[model samples]
Target: TTGNISFRNETTFGGSGTVTYRWLVNNVQVATSTDLNYNFTVPTGATMPYMFTVKLEASNIVGCKTVQEKTVQFNPFPRALFNVVQARGCAPFNLQIGNQSTNADQYEWYLDGTLVSTLHSPNNIVLNDFDRTYTLRLLVKNQYGCIQDEQSVQVSTYPYLKAEFDVANDLSCNGILDVQITNRSVGATTYTWDYGDGSPVYVGNNPSHSYGRQGVFTLKLTASNGFCSDIFTKTVSVSNTPSASFTSNVRSGCNQLIVRFRNTSINATEYLWDFGDGAFSREENPEHQYAFANTAFTVKLTVVNQYGCRDEVSATNFIAVSPPPQANIEVAPARVIKVPNYSFTFKAVTTDDIILYRWDFGDGTSSDRSEVTHKYDRFGTYKVKLFITNRNNCTSVIEEEVI
Candidate 1:
């Protein structure tokens, strides 16, 4: 800071004996001289824009004196200094600021080249957006219209981590439970997985796992970005399957055959038996009867478990039924001599076990014999009919002519 002084000297006499000048600041004399030029510098560490009362005194040898006074104002430049409470944090971060400026009448703040606050001391600034870096600037201006250099600070932000996942092949059959896990987390660098089967923990973005047993299980996933971590969980269900098998007591018999079935299935709660002969049963052990002879029947057994898993077993030609015997007869003399009495010998031909037979000569005569000799009184023509029955109560009939 600099100040200047100007003074004029006057004398009544043309030739002056002596002329003296005196200058004082704030009512204190500091210089005495004959020269008209006066200059001084302000002291350091003094208050800015200081006011001073400067006086100039002029004296001649005749003792004539004059005095002049003026007031001068001095101002200094401002100093800018500040600090941020926190420079780096996660999103939605709050930052406290401190202003330590000197000789400043107003303050202005800028963030990322945009003005944010103008107060001398601003409130806490919150940054809720994600960015790699942010620039904060502060400007201080003094009453002298002099502005300080811009002061700046840099703040860093870390990315937020989220955990999410999905499961594939969750439902399985035949007691084989295999699952594929997919990770859907964002802004993560590492992952950890828990399958919830008392097994070892796994670490990966995607993985496949097999369960030793069947039931419901819970899975967990954790993701981290070295600064923040998040977790997610899900529930999965597994089903148990059953094995079906069966046995039968009788495989082949005569018509109207009765067969007993035994069910042999594992992990089953319900059963269904289908006998190929248009018969169905729900009993674990059931009895079925076949009515058609000379026919083969297929048997099927299906079992279901508590988890709604099912299995089936089938046997082709599991049961066979046979028909009763058929009877036929042949006579040695089909046509006997047309005399008063003729005798014919008849023999029974059969394919099955016959227990009883009845023979009629068609001439009002009958006999019960497998092989017999029949005598006909009238010899024009005679029809012989035979009926036979098997041990199973199945019967057959045949007719022959004797002439």
Candidate 2:
């Protein structure tokens, strides 16, 4: 601080005609010129409220001397001091500043090299730069412009963390459930996982796990950077296995056999049937026709679920089909028979095995034999019929006319 001092009155009391003026500060001479104004500067590194004495002496050739003295007080310099509650924390760090400066009349605060506040003790200072440092400064000045001081501190911050992940295989079937995980997180250094299946918690990234049973489960992942953490969750579903089974109305029949199949499968969503006769079907319950005679055929069934798990069953030689006997009638002794005592021989012929034969004459007489001789009482024209049955109870008939 500096100031100018002057002896205002130019006239000296009881002095000689010509006067010499001398100025002294703190008992040391600074100027001896006739100019009354003196420029005074406080010494460097002077404390606040510094006091000094300014004196002036008037002397002439007559040897008369007079002295005038005055004391001066300067304004105090301000001391700027402060403390922060916390200097380092996670992102969006909150700060509580305490102002403990002395002899200060004005205050200025700067954050990250930008002036932000002028209050002596500002509240609610928040910093949002992640993983970086900033400078917080405080400047204080006295009321009279004597001096000003400033203090600064370094504010540090940690990074903001996020947790993210994905399930590669969330679905399974056939009583087997296996899961795969993928990590896709940002600003994270550590990881934790929970499969939510009554198992131990896992600690790592991208882990594979298997469940013992079929059901739905929840999955959780936590990511951390040692100072902050985040959490993410998901759900998974599993299904049961499939079993194939079926039943038929009949196993064996004559030619042109028709069969009805009934399906009884567990945990099956789809069905396929192979009738072993160069035929196939996809219906759950189906009816089939077998046309090959005197032949046996096998049947098979396959079932599948939504998860692409499948099971198959086959019944070998499950159906038997038989051919009916084709009957032929032959009458001997000529086409015309004599009246009274006319005897005609009847014969039945077939390629298949015959269990029984029946013969019906036009004269109301019938016989149950492969060949028979019949005598008609009276007949102008007559029709003879033959019926043959195979071992499978399948029958065929033929008729012939005689005169």
Each prediction's TM-score versus the true structure: 0.42, 0.49
Q: Counting only residues 3 or more apart in sequence or on different chains, how many pairs clash (N, Cα, C under 3 Å) in candidate 1?
A: 2
Q: What is the lDDT of residue 144 in candidate 2?
A: 78
Name the best candidate (by lDDT): 2
lDDT of 2 by residue, 250-279 (tens): 988888999999999998889999999999
Q: After superposition, how far is residue 10 of candidate 1 from its true place, in Å?
A: 11
Model 1 scores worst on lDDT over the 10 consecutive residues at: 7-16
Model 1: per-residue Cα lDDT over 118-167, one tens digit each: 88778766666765688888988876786575689997677766789888
Whole-model Cα lDDT of every candidate shown, in order: 0.81, 0.84
